[model samples]
Target: MNRRGLWSVRWRSAVVWVWCSFCLLTLASLTLRYIVLYIHPDHDTHRERWCPPEPVESDECYSWRPVLLPHATCGCTRRILIRHTCSEDLSPKMWDGQANSTCDPDGSVRGPQQLVMSISTPFLTPKRLATLSYTITQVNELYRGWVLRVYTRVNKHSLPSLCSLVCAHPNLDVCDITAMSETANTVHHAAWRWGVVGDPLVSTWALRYLHHALLPRDAHALTQFINSNKCWHLMKDHPTHSHSVLGSGLLAGKTSWGLSELTGIRKRILLTRHVVEEEQVFRDMVTPVIGRDVMTHDSLTCYTSAGAVPFPSRRSPGQWVGMPIPTLTNSPQNQNKSHKNATDIMPPQLKVFSVKYNSKVNTTDGFQIIKNQADNDDVNEMEREHINRKNGIPRCPHSCRPPLHPNWDYC
Candidate 1:
């Protein structure tokens, strides 16, 4: 053994020790980051883009919910690769920029991170919610969708004052209010509107004359809106591809769901300012005749003269028993001309009927208007006593009344 050999061995030992120390430190750093990140983890390092399971088709609503994450988490600040159809990667302006972009099968949706209303990083507070609510009222008439309330929550301990303030917010349902304050690293929520209405029923007014008819001319329009359809979709016959339990129930007046089943569904119809915003032919005639407030309210009264209106075959599934229902579809583009002409759109059969509406509830039990063939269509002849009552008409402003003018009936 020589001095040179001894020196080489000592140097090799020192290098190995240094390398081991560096590797141990690096491993520790990564572990800590993993623990800190579970919520809104770094997009670059963690593949936080967990493609959640799509919501199953519910019996109540045509729409489904795909849970984005397990809990409220901050929006991923980094660009996330989204490879799914009908889902945007928490990013905005990705697909909107493409004029004719369809949901591509193999293609992916990508862009800037989608920013949502959260406590931090574009923080939105309780004060903002109230301000937003107030502002909504001002422009509510101008736009159809106005949210009177918002539901959200935050870590009470992280910002107790902000948490308390938000929790106490009126019209807000702040879940998990008592939990310890979470660090600002996490986000809470945002809610989407579903058109479901409570246990509801509609009363149809029956009529026989062609001289004066309310809904006979606009029955299709009323039915369209009542079925949670857009006016334009009603114009020529394009169904929005969405369905509602309330609308379904009203069609048969039998499938009416209990509160539990009804609440499960949200989309009853687009709760726009006007029930029939499209089908312009009914424009000036129907709206002014029937107050907008009454038509759009959660409940509605339908005065059908002649017991039947020219309802789109699709709109009324079981209204006519044993008769094949027509699938009356309209043009999507007709939405453009929806507000155009009122008188020109009515089908002649509708001439024998009319419709009026009331928001007030007439009865807890629903109503159905059956065709009375033997008697005269005049109000007096079609009295409740004279009519054949198979299914009792539901409560209404004028239930079991003859198919006559609203003025004559004072309904």
Candidate 2:
């Protein structure tokens, strides 16, 4: 061939070779992606599990994870894009301005990172299992979602100090504690209120009441607090004020969640000072009527009347079923009104039946009003007969007779 034709052939061949290599690489990449997709159809760079087939009724899909990177720390400035309909980025106001802000979403990932630890058949470490138990208590405070405790080794080498996500629905059986821990990153320990008795059942009613009654009463403040993301802070910090802030319009507890189901599904977020704080809160609440040590046996007898204080409603707040439950009405705003006048704000004809203050009753009469409720008349009659057979003075009216045993007494 001629020299020019030979060179042209060589160049064309080179060009063809480069093009073929590029096409082959592209095909290989696509094949790899398909294989990965088949294996993990729900994987995401964001670490959130891909949303399964579900009704997309809401504005945004419910994704709990945010891919917390190792770089981000509390109060640090990181560029993260918040995809929620409400905001473009995580604002400084959300974390009480303790964290720095940057509206830029170029690189930073928001929220908790997906736990990368793998799961095995059984966890192998005694020490890590112990630490995991401690970690679960901390995680339960923030994320109340259901998870499983796993105690197994990965690859038979790495110690199992890790928690895995237990989201395998229908595919897996009982979830392990390891799955629960995977949902959170570094748990910054904070002081939480003790034994406030967080029944999700009660919380549902309480939250509804707060949203309807309490929020409406002080609409401006409530709106501001909610908008500024201060409601969570108030709940965590000023627990006493939290009740008033949300309780002014609270309805009574309901019975939607069966006790059996609640016990199984609902998890307890154990806090450090649960019992101590619970006692303090109770003392603060009932101190005016029963005084300190109101949680004692004497106080318990007084609390028997609690059932008679009707709960709000099973569904809606303020909508009574059998009877209306009594709630404290005097917010700091309107505390000086006459007790009788305060009834105007409350449901008319509703009374705190079967509940009476010892302070409200006089103790002078031997034939005082029967302390036993009218509902217990049969039991009272039996007691009366027994008392008469013994040494009986006439039945003590409006109260139960003192037992002959010196140690036994009623408050």
Candidate 3:
């Protein structure tokens, strides 16, 4: 072949090699992208799957499973708990005749049964359905012996504003309010989620849980969502996954110390490390203090999973969040005797814990208003117990709900 022909062939070969190299690089990049997505599924799609509707109008949230976690923070678990916890005044000074003093007149006070729809937002939780539902079929069975009603646009939002609207219109019943909005079709549509889904099971269950469960659990959910008032960057293990480093937040609040009380915990160690070093950090800092008590360890060490970004993790160190209180020993024999003095408290929770004290059990429960008193206070406690029983009230089982972040799986 001539020199010119040979040079032409070489040039063609070089072009082909460059093209093949580009394609291979593109394929590799795509593969790496897929792997990253698989390891850390984009929570947005998960949020979209779980929250199909707008966050505020999600018919309450789908991910809010009926399962309650052991470390729930408030008496706000199911809708019943929301009604019982959010409505009924927890104050000892609240007179017996006026049980609904703190509750919205148009809301929790008006009906013992309620159904709630909540928006599931990544940053915020629906806090006030004070109601719940399951897959019950019959509509009548669901709302049996309960009043099903739609009341307010303001109620569609939080009660703080609608509550004020209700005071002026005390005579306006839910039917009246719902009817008043009927002609204003758009108004009703936004607030009217009743029978929204054609599915009988979903619709009837929503109705039943709204009323029978006392309140929609969403109400309780909102009550517990104080972990953060507004959505901000989460600096901990995405609130859903279990980890060994936990911390309180400007909004991601702490869990109950009661679980520690019940389980008999003493020393709790919370550690923070670069998100890149999550496993190593847990092994090095937290494991020893927690010993092999897996449950306790997981619950206490929740904040460590902040993503590996250097800037964010620096601000949020893993923390020891539970109250500094005495806990029972691991041994059954010394268990009760170990935490004999639980009276000492850190703060905040001490304000309202007075509601559960029993004279017989000596719950050692304290109140912010009435800390320590003489034997006469025991008489007062007995009187309070009788009043509570008379009212068919029980001490709230949940004052808080479990974490709602996509990472934590109460299910």
**Number of clashes found in candidate 3:** 46
- In model 1, state the lDDT of residue 73: 29
Worst 10 residues of 1 by lDDT: 202-211
Candidate 3 lDDT tens digits, 302-378: 33332211110000111112222122123434322312122212122321232332221221111011123222233
Off by over 4 Å in 2: 1-57, 61-65, 71-83, 90-278, 286-411
Better of 1 and 2 by TM-score: 2
lDDT of 1: 0.26
On a 0 to 100 scale, what is the lDDT of residue 214 in model 1?
A: 23
Q: Which stretches of candidate 1 lie over 4 Å from their true place?
A: 1-395, 399-411
Task: Indicate whether candidate 1 or candidate 3 has the larger TM-score.
Answer: 3
- Over 4 Å off, model 3: 1-12, 21-54, 57-305, 308-320, 326-411
Model 1 lDDT tens row, 111-148: 11111111111223433332332222222221121112
Which numbered prediction scores highest in TM-score against the true structure? 3
Model 2 agreement with the true structure over 141-204: per-residue lDDT tens digits: 2122312122222342332222121121101111222323432111111111111112221221
lDDT of 2 at 410: 15
